[model samples]
Target chain A: MLTLFYILSAITLGTAFLTILSKNPIHSAIYLVLCFFSIAGHYLMFNAQFLFIVHIIVYSGAIMILMLFTIMLMNLNKADEKNKPILSRIAAVVAFCLVALVLLATFIKSQPVINEYKVSGQDFQSIKVLGQVLLNNYMVPFEFASVLLLVSMIGAVLLSKKEHINN
Target chain B: MDQAIIIEKGIFIVVIFAITMLFAMYETLAERKIAAWFQDRVGPNRAGKGGILQPLADGLKLFSKEEFFPNTENRFLFIAGPAISMTTALMTSAVIPWGDKLTLFGRDVILQATDINIGMLYVFGVLSVGVYGIMIGGWASNNKFSLMGAMRASSQMISYEVAMGLAIICLVMMTGTLSLGEIAAGQHGWRWNVLYQPVGFIIFLVCSFAETNRTPFDLAECEAELIGGYHTEYSSMKMGFYLFAEYASMFISSTILAVLYFGAYNYPGMDWVESVAGANIANIIGIFVLFAKICFFIFFYMWVRWTIPRFRYDQLMKLGWKMLIPLAIANIIVTGIIILLADQNL
Candidate 1:
């Protein structure tokens, strides 16, 4: 199980690096998809099958497709993108280092303890249990999320609509 | 896991893979033969014995054809597209319960590849990924028509999938299970979900047609407009893979439809047969019966293809968003009400 975790983590990090390193936009998108898939693999390794499938469905399936479509629509396949200015490049490097340092500092400060694994007989992550929890306990948050989504969808539709002109 | 159990799983996977490929192969022939019959023309009878060996011949031809690649910047994605499609198509069968269980060689064997709790969700996830295949392929082709086809396919599939998921929610409510095996088991001896949720079934059927890009919802591959659609730039075995993946998906979807709504591997006299002929023999017949239902659905797909003209893109979207989505939602609401009412009464 540890070996599987290491392998999945490796895959996830490798593809994530490739997603940025790849020159072509399409290649980057595909690599991003691979990265998402690997993350889903990690979820599966943790035995969170429901989360794994949902993650794949939402990220790799829908969001990535939308990203790819936008990329293709923009015809950004050519390697004609200008390199960042030297100042911007240096700033980006500094920003990356800062973020990494902060993340490392946070991790070190937390002093997280690993709990001994215990097998729970309850099927907590199954659809039925999840559904009950969502509807009963997290009902308000769930409904708020749906409302937010609906508002966004309506906004998108309204923005995309062509104006009617009377002659 | 025990070595014997591992071996059994390995064998099961191999068998399922082989069956998927075989069914996909014959589906091509069946499509051709059925199309010919509809058009009053004899199909390819030249290969061997009413062209029974036609798919083999077709495979050979595709294999021998010159490998052709269009001028494209993303060669990797072009190749990955069909591979993804084929893989996802085959992956769906993993959760499908082909039969109940068979007693073989002093051991009980489950016919399904895996009996995961989230079988329906897994299928939906894999199917949603199928859009990437067409999208990547079309984009990699560096052709406008192909890109347009891919765009249409992605949008159409996404829209219809909403309806499909909603329709399935009705079934999930009815069965009170997401596991395909459990759903199939619930449909014992003619208590099929289709009988209970006819509206949901029809919505699901339509959404499936759209999802699979069959005729009437095949705006992505309108030959007159898109010029071979997303596969316009592919040739030889790569193109064959895309086509094969479509038929494989069709077969899988048919199997899903059967297992979900049509009482998979369950007939009226199944209990009687089991009592008389024993568990092993009964399950063997059950497997055959399941396949028969799958074949009928496959035929129904082809039948609808030949009978209906392709829908205009707007009409397709309208049907998906306006018609099917509302219907599916209504079905869900109605199902929920009935269930609540029944619970209250009980």
Candidate 2:
């Protein structure tokens, strides 16, 4: 299990890096899809099958496809993004190093904790259990999310609608 | 897992893969033969007796054809498109319950690849990914026509999928299970879900027709408009992969429709048959029965393809978004009310 976790995490990190490093927007989108898939693989490794499927469906299937469509529609295939100014690049590097230092400092400070995993015998992540939790506990938030989505959809339709001019 | 179990699973996977390929191969021939019969003509009688070996000849011809790649920038994605399509097309068969368990060597063997708890959702997820195949292929081709076709295909699929999900929600509510095996098991004897959820079944059927890009909803590849559509630039085996993947998906969709709405492997007097003819024989019969249902669906696909003309793009969108989606939602609401009333009566 540990070995599988390491392998999946490596894949996830590798694809995530590639997603940004790829020049073409299409390639970046494909890499992002691969990254999402590897994350889904990680979910599967943790025995969260419902989350794994939902993650793949929402991320790799729907969201990535939409991203790809937008990329293709905009014809964003050229590797012509302008390089950042030297001062901004230097600042970016400094910021990255600062974040790395802070992360390392936190890791060192928390090093005494044992990294053992306890397997929960309960099928807490199963669809039935998840549905119960969502309906009973997270019902309001879930309904809000749905409402938010509906509003956005209506907003999109309204924005896309053409106006008529009377002669 | 034990070696024997591993070997059993390996054999099952191989058998399923082989059957999918074989059915896809013959579906091409069947499509031609059926089309010819409908047109009052003999189809491909030159390749062996009654064109039984036509698919083989076609395969050989396709293999020998030149592998032509267009002057496109994203070659990797161009190749990945058909590969993704073919892979996803074959993957959906894994969750389908081919038959009841067959007893062998003092052990019972379930005739399915893997009975995942979320079988239906898995199928839906994989199917949604199938859009990428066309989208990538068309985009990588750098052809405006191909891109347009891909756009239409993706949008149509996305639109129809909403209605399809709503339709399936009704089924899921009725069966109270996400597992296809459990659903099939619930439909014992002739107690098919279609008898109860007729509107849901119709909605699902229509959405499936749209989802599979068949006639009346095949706006993606309307040759009259898009010039062969998303596969306009593909040639040789690449083109063959796209076409074969369509047939494979068709076969898989038919199997899904059969397993979901139809009786799956169930038949009249199946229990009696099992009692009289022995479990093994009865299960074998059940497998054949499932294939028969699948074949009927395949034939139905072709029948519709030849009979119905392709829908205009606007009409397709209107049907998907306006007609099917509302109907599916209505079906779900009615199903929920009926279930609640039934519970109250009980």
Candidate that would win on lDDT? 2
How many clashing pairs does model 2 include? 0
Q: Give the fraction of reference interface contacts each candidate recovers.
A: 0.85, 0.74
Q: Mind giving the per-residue lDDT tens digits that candidate 2 earns over B1-346?
A: 4888889989999999999999999999999999999999998899899999999999999999999889987788899889988999999999999999999888789999999999999999998999999999998898999999999999999888888999999999998999999999888889988898899888888888988888878888988889988999999999999999999999999999999999899988999998998989988998999999999999999999889888889998888888988888888898899999999999
RMSD of 2: 3.8
RMSD of each: 3.2, 3.8
| Alpha-carbon runs more than 4 Å astray in model 1 | A77-121, A162-167
- Report the TM-score of chain B alone for all candidates: 0.98, 0.98
Clashing pairs in 1: none
Candidate 2: regions farther than 4 A off:
A77-121, A162-167
- Which 10 consecutive residues of model 2 chain A have the lowest summed lDDT? A111-120
Task: Please state the error at residue B342 of candidate 2 in Å.
Answer: 0.5
Name the lDDT of candidate 2: 0.90
DockQ of each model against the real complex? 0.76, 0.72
Best by DockQ: 1
TM-score per model over all chains:
0.92, 0.92
